[model samples]
Target: MAVKGLNRPVIPFMAYLLAAILLAMTPAICLIPLVDSVEVWQGLEANTRDLRAQTESGILLSMGLVDTGLKLFDNTLNHEMEEAFGPVVAEYERAEGNPGAMDLSRVREELDGRMEIYIINESGVIEYTTYLPELGYDFREIPYFYDRITEIRLGGFFSADRVVAGIPTGEFRKYAYLPSPDHRYLLELGLAPSEFHESRMALKYGDAVRELVNLNPEILKIRIFDCLGTRIVGEECPDDDRRLSLVRQAYRERTTLEVENATARELTRYLFVDLSDNDYASDMSMVVELTYTTKAAEEKVAGMFARQGGVLLFGFALIGCLCAVAMHSLIRPVRNFVEDVDLIASGDLDHPVRVGGSEELVHLGESVSAMVGSLKETIQRVRASEEAIIRHSHTLEEQVRERTADLEESNRMTTLLLDIMRHDISNANNVANLYADLLATEIEEEAEAELLRRAKAGLAKSIEIARDVNTIQHIEGGLPSPGPVDLDRIIRAEIERSPGARITYTGRPVEVLADDLLSEVFTNLIGNAVKFGGPEVGITIRVEELGEEVVVSVEDDGPGIPDAVKPRLFERLSRGTYKESGTGLGLYICRMLITRYGGEIRVEDRPEGGTAIRFSLRRAGTGGEP
Candidate 1:
């Protein structure tokens, strides 16, 4: 049956789909039994059980042989120790009443083969020993001394593995101890692991304990523990808490224990065995634990799974090919429709979609072509509107340029007219002063000559006013290029040029960011000070450095500037005092020039007497313009 919206003739599509489904199911049917069948699971379990049994048997047999060998060595050593010291101990007990009569040193020499003797006196001091350095040592404080004495007092030698120090060399000796002579002294003797198999009686068993450890490759570790849970011999034992728990369980129960927890990586089995038989302590036991890792079992299981995994991989490959073929048939018609729709959306409407496999796709292609035809008509209208807008914007840009040019031309003419007026007025004032000087030479009356001189001075002042106005125009029009200027050099030059004023400059060499006009700032301030401060004006110029700028001050010792006048000292056409014949533009020009250089100028009353005119300028970079 055909699905909804798939309104095409679908008999062929349905047949292809049925063939693909059957092809995919064929491999799955064959491989399912190979993976999850009852026979396969049973085989894996059977192999694991067999391997575990073999590992257990080998480990148990080795441990049993080792236990038997160590027991034999313990009994032989105890018997030999008793035979050598049995009689001497009896004689020493009989001579206890006369302690001084027994020769302990001679007794030590006689029993000094394969053993060392210490003859501790009644006072618990080692009075004589085969090892001379131990002779004067006090034995009362040592635990082993008292433990051995207690054992011997009950009429038996104390025997165990212990560490003891030897003669003058003071080297360690691992050994067994034999206490005798009525607990007055004790003898220690031991055999190394290699020496245990040297005797003919021990050779029959043939180093079984050491040999068993070497034979097994699966055994990761084997350890032997004494009754006290102290390790006696074996490989270095594992420090895992679970392994320690197993060893402790065996020691306490005096029985065999086998533990295998889920989290444990190795199987551990602890077997407690008696190491003493006949004339040896019955409570003495040794714990032998064997540890075998899961390496062999894991390797077997990994190989089985690897083989089965190969079959499953082939099954998946066959399924993937069938699905690829079936999906291509279902998706090719839909994919072609989508591609055509994307092309039209991305602005390509000329190519029409021609997909014709099914009825639904044919109808979709016809709808796309109709929509593309409508989109083409709308784009033509948009293009025509954009062209008209671009033309209007170009016309506006030309009109703005023309208006800007007219404004620039008008500004130039105004500047030129001011320059001509200043020059002509200055020439007229200079000619009038020359005529006044000529008239002064001919006239005889004193009053007439004085009047003429006053008129001449007025004309000179007017000329000066014209020159100041021209300078102000130049400053307002545009500022000059600024560079480093030496402050100390400028101050000294201006002081020498001022003939009337006695100026004293005291400052270190400093540079400021200002152009050649910087000298004019100092010259005007000094000249104004000389004129305003009577004939004998005393001026002191000081230059001080601020963080990123320098301040220059001109202090005059004369009548100080008034509070009202100080505020307007740098204002245009303003004067400190109206008594002097001078243009008021000097301080104003100074303020303008300082400000143009991103600096400031102001006047304040001097602390000593007169006025201090200070101006600030940026400190210039060293060596040049920066």
Candidate 2:
């Protein structure tokens, strides 16, 4: 059987399988790069820490070597002075008794190699010495040698300077005077500055030590100060400007001035080591100044980081390439499935996709194939059913039309009869009531008066029925057109017309696009409230204007309609569970009239009490009320 226009072909199974595969591959591809970048960052961080540690270690080791070498040089100089001076003083003492065998020149030459040797006599006189021409005058005129000879009574030593080899130079030379057994003559040995320079030259790794450890070799300046922070040697010796500045700073602050300029750049990391002997060793109190360039250390660290980054990049690239190949292989099936689905969606479901690897995809293809077969069968079945239903529907519609025509004819006949009877009977009942009064007065018999009373009662019932019939006719004819009307006036008039009903207006004056029809609407709503509600029931008319619509609510404090009947309240001939006397067309007519004017009407249970009938009328625009 051929299906109707609604028939649709089923999608192929392979297409669905491809879609799922592609969706799964997307995240996998994204994670590949993310994971690789994280690994690279981790490696770089580790390399940075290692490089910092290595740089710090190298700096500490270099400083240690410099300090050790300085210590050795100081010790050797001190020992050499003590050894060479001891013998010279002994010879001077022994010769004091025999002036003929004194031989000062020979004594000086013998001690020359033993120390930075020079000779001074018992009177603090430079009598003979190596480099003799450089001592322009006798040592007796020199205060340092004289002071040492007088102060060191038992041949103790003092450091001083003098001419050596005809050139004036500074040295850590020791002067000692030994008294003869007769206590008449003294001898002295002075170490020249040349001896200290020679000792520095003889040290192992001397050149490398000077090159690496010299803080500022190009503008090299060295100053040594005593424990009291007073300069003892170097250029501008004993009172060099740099040394004095350091001494003054220490004196004012009362602390050691140890500054290390560890980099050539203006930025330098300096440690001010405290020289307080009260809590530490005397050797530790000696503050060493070191200066070096940070450029080298910075370069080394940068190189290490760069190398690490390069290695990481290379490794990640390799991994990424391998992953890409694997990802392509895994995702190709998904791509093919997607293309197949696209073709199916574009209305070409005839082509079947070629099945590939993976059990999941194969199962999906099978499912899709089964679904397509089922869909094709369903389409054929649906088509046949549709044709049969169409034929049956046409027959049913014809029958319904015939029945509706008959029903309308019957309704018209009934309405005509009811109208004629209501008019004729109402008139006859009025005439009968008038004649009964006359007859009752004229006859004046008890039996006749009772009969007249019965007749009058029947007349009243007939009149009531006539009124109900008239009301139904007026409503069924369609409500009158509306113009601008005061909603308050209409509500008040309805309340007055139905006096027995309790009516309350809780809103201000609200003008609406309505006329007599508004009055009719209110009349019907108010009448219903009074007729169906208890004596105590109150009717409230609420009016409000929303942006482009005016709403009016007529709420009644009455027993609400049952839930089952509420949905059908606006339907023709629908009645509530409560058997109130009504044609059941009042709400239906109300809905029709309101809808014709672009308004809505609804009935709902009141929040606190009975039932509320709400209707909204659209505000006037350039066109008539909508």
Candidate 3:
């Protein structure tokens, strides 16, 4: 008993140490994510600030280039005009902002359509132009464009904007403005794209976009949209009405706008860039669409996660290693003590048990070692007692065999009594039924006669119960083996037993693997349906050949079994319903017999509102039915 108790395991303390370690590390581990979050937030803020400055600086630099390039470009145009019609433009100066004093028709013939020159009066109206379309166009209706020209009419230096599409026509053109010497009218030259424009690459927006994108890693894309809401530089995407509206808003407000698009994982920045002057840069003004990514901050957070995980892994491994080294001193002695005790318990009394470590461990080893000597003597006495017990057990075995024989005799007697009781029950119910038949014949009144008939029916039901009891009692015992049996013959015979029943069967010649008792299965099922469904009930006996097995379902238009009772219908003493007659052992016996023939039976609900007892038996032969 003591040895067994020593071998029995006690509740373990494995989790305590691990819990302590986790508790100790809780603060540090919890701090990791918080620190990571702060770092990410800081990184994003710093990145946004740096890129904001960079973006504004780049815009300012581009504006400066556009401002300077206008002067050089305008001077070239003015030089060309002077060469073409130096005397003509000097002749037209006396028009006094009227532009009708000179022969402009002769100047237009000299120019030959290389460029179109516009004479804008101080009131910002185009009074004369080489192009006939602007013979006397008024720019005053357009408050923004008129304001830009007024500023140019007022400013000293000549300025031009980058090539842009027309506001309404969408035609590409570049215009530079200069003050005609007397400032009476502003001389404006509109230049279409030609070989001369290729030399003026200083104001190309495409170059600026490409440069910014190439220099900044966070800049995924850059697009410049002109005042007409057309993407002039960078890649072109499909027109987004929302985005175009936002661009128009930026142009109106002349302020920067930012939209963080989570689905695209980028921040869209709209920088309303003003060229030359805020009000005067109407055609030159544009919105810079900057798409920025924060890949650096995301990578920083991911890197921190990986590094922290590695550090935690290393810390855990170090703890494990230190624990293993420390446990060796205590574990070795305990392990040796357990092993030696186990060995002694397994009949190896001579096995040594020595533990050297702490004073308590030494004392335990000494005490156990002394116990082992006493155990050795005790084991000898136990061995002697065991030998005597073996001899006594042999005698007990003989007595057990005699008791077993008596038990078998008792079982046989019980079975005999069951047979006698079944016979007596059958005989007694048959006599009662005979008396009921006689009483039924003597009754003249119809109601009294009906009562006698019901009494006989009940007596017959009792007789069925007696036979069912006999059949069910020995269901678990041996039965006849399966053999070739006429399926139709058996079904037809069972059908004949109930002549008046509404049984439907398309008889066909078939053979199945079952003994003569297969008829009992049909009997119990058919009788059950008739007893419950009454005379008008319809019954269907169906047989289907499926591969090596033949399935048969005996269904009736009786009150269908409840779904809850279907599972246990074939179990011993499981009646269909309390109101039905006969013992519940009929279906149970059928199941046992079907099982003996290597078939299975089950209770099911027929689709046509009835209960069905379905069973399967193997085909008689390997080939088609004989």
Candidate 4:
């Protein structure tokens, strides 16, 4: 049985497809989470930088504005005090009569509408307050102005204690002092701490910074820290301890540090540099600790990748199924064609392959069908030729048998006629002989007696004719039962029987499985050689043993057989158109009987002279066994 093509192993193709899918999805599914985590960290870092920049800008702008206002107030107060006290000191120094000419009312009235300034005497005591209604204050005991004049040599800004009249409130204040030109008085400018605080708050950009931090909270942790790394704003992070050592390290290093936690989560820590560049503030640094929990986003991205992998796997499976089906469909017809070819090769050319669907297969099927038809026709023709050969063989055999039978019957009839004629003639001759003997006994003529002897010789001729006819009948009747016969015996018998032919024999006793039939063969061959051979012709018989058979050749020195007749020399009724004369059944009968006993005969022209009749007979069984 032919093997099926479609049923061949599919593992190789399946393995290739599986390997291709695995190769395609491995990197995509495994690396997406890593990429997303990096992206989130970068986004958070950008946000933190932006917040720092905005906060720093706001702080600087606010400080600039507050310093400008304080400088203006100090300049105005110093000018008014110096103008009011310049004349008083001049008058006190140039007093001709009474040195009490320093008019305090004039000084107060002169600076009334321009300033709410305080005037203090040389003793660090407030002499008169322009904005206060209390008359004559202690001239040397108010410590705020007193401290300012004493500590600040040329009247600079200072923080001091102050009491306001209208609101009845006392609070810390910012003061600027002015010394009199004559060194007799001092003037002070005070700024409430509430006003300073209000101005500072107005300039704070914390809200904008907070908005930026809130925009992307995943990676950013905005915290305000004292110079010592204390958390002051935003989410309460762990205090700076061993656990927060990484954050501190990042701050001290002023670089971003990335670390992986126990769960394979990545953390990136960055220090928030102080947005405030205050040289006077005790806690000058504000740290914005940014802690990013990338695990969730990493998980989300990992899940997305997993889903994509599933989609890809499903797609690959679907594609694999389709490919398998397509391959099967493609190969099915070819497989079927192979099977059909196999069947045809095995001598079953009846069925043709079925072809449908694909164009190439259809064309192939047509070609194969054509080949099958041609093969069938060829087989039919071969069978017809074989049948013809069988019929011809049978016809040839029947012809040979029929001819042999006819020749035998004719030989019988000829022998019977010759016997009767010999008998009658012999009787007539005997009467003649008797009469002649009687005459011879009566008469005494010696010459007449001689004539009578000559007349008696005719009877002898008649007897010889009868014997020759009998020999012919015996030979034609297919010879007697064959026995172990020697080739020399048959050759010698033929030579002795036909004295007219110059005959020669060669070889020793070459025994054959033969009988009287061999004698007939020799007789006919020698007779033909003698009759057809010219008067000066000679005949020779050669015998040789060839394996299990004995080859005997009867050759003549007569004119060779004509080329036209040589082809049919062993055929019935086929004779050479030469001087040879005989019934044509001689060699034909010889060949038939020889062939029946597992022997063969053929005729060929001898190199030197006439035709050679060669025949082979089975050698007699060794040990006298049949």
Among these predictions, the greatest TM-score belongs to 3
lDDT of 3 at 51: 72
Query: Model 3, 432-542: lDDT tens per residue?
Result: 888887777678998888888778768877887787776766564556567799999999998888898999999698888777778889888888887888888999999
**TM-score (C-alpha, index-matched) for candidate 4:** 0.27
lDDT by residue (tens digit), candidate 2, 405-448 = 99999999998997898789888878887887787778778897
* lDDT (10s digit) by residue, model 1, range 324-406: 87678767877777776787789877755746455656666776677678878888998998899899989988998888888
User: Which residue pairs come into collision in candidate 1?
Assistant: none
Which ranges in model 1 have alpha carbons more than 4 Å from their true place? 1-73, 76-105, 108-306, 342-350, 355-626
lDDT of each: 0.66, 0.58, 0.73, 0.58
- Candidate 1 residue 333 C-alpha distance from true site, Å: 1.6
Candidate 4 Cα deviation (angstroms), residue 153:
99
TM-score-best of 1 and 3: 3
Residue 475 of model 1: what lDDT?
A: 79
